[model samples]
Target: MARKEFQHYEAVSAAVPGDGAYSAAIAVKGLGAGGAPTFHRVLQDQTFKTALAADQAAVQELERLIDVTSEGELMFAQD
Candidate 1:
């Protein structure tokens, strides 16, 4: 049995199209056959300053969902 190497790109975003506010998985990849991949936050540059739940359970749940390494990146989107 042989296993194949696969490269996949997945992103989740939410916003009213043409609203000038959007968030997407904009992967910054280097051009050419072999390239490096990087992630960036596009648009939606708004000041998000607000207190959140002190409960650690909720925080942990969010961390589990998104592979977050930094703090204070509280992200939430609609259904």
Candidate 2:
């Protein structure tokens, strides 16, 4: 979906973190064809640490679910 939206815009840019951190922003030009570009910056040291940890936990949970699903294993929905 993001790719499709980017196609609508004439210009766009992106960047990825190198050292355990990442930040990027996008700029679009035009109306519904592009609209306004969004800017986002993240410094993953202090404030970003909490968010990063939460995301890692979520990924771990997903991996466990995938393992169960592959093995035809069943567990409580709450788990």
Candidate 3:
């Protein structure tokens, strides 16, 4: 897993085990907040062969995130 600090939030890469593969996802949470962190699944239409690959891909996608809204929304960089 990869973690990065973003203002008052901390974003981390996650690999969700599926039937035969892993799903790329990012988990974001407020640095000092109380509630559970929110999860944002990325590259939804794709699956990785390994958890490591999924985590790496999630990290890349996390890097592409421009911001995490106050309401826990993910803002992506436009192409």
**Where's the lowest-lDDT run of ten residues in candidate 1?**
1-10
Q: How far is each candidate from the true structure, as Cα RMSD in Å?
A: 13.6, 13.8, 1.4
lDDT score at residue 78, model 1, on the 0-100 scale: 30
What are the models' TM-scores? 0.22, 0.23, 0.87
Q: Candidate 3 — which residues are off by over 4 angstroms?
A: none
lDDT of 3 by residue, 1-79 (tens): 8887778788889998988999999999999888878888899999999999999999999888888888878888997
Worst lDDT run of 10 residues, candidate 2, spans 66-75
Top-scoring candidate (lDDT): 3
Q: Report lDDT per candidate.
A: 0.29, 0.32, 0.89
Q: Between the candidate structures 1 and 2, which one is better when assessed by lDDT?
A: 2
In model 2, pairs of residues that clash are none
Evaluated with TM-score, which candidate comes out highest? 3
Compose the digit string of candidate 1's lDDT tens values, residues 1-79. 1111113332222222223423332232322435544434434343122212112222332333333223313233433
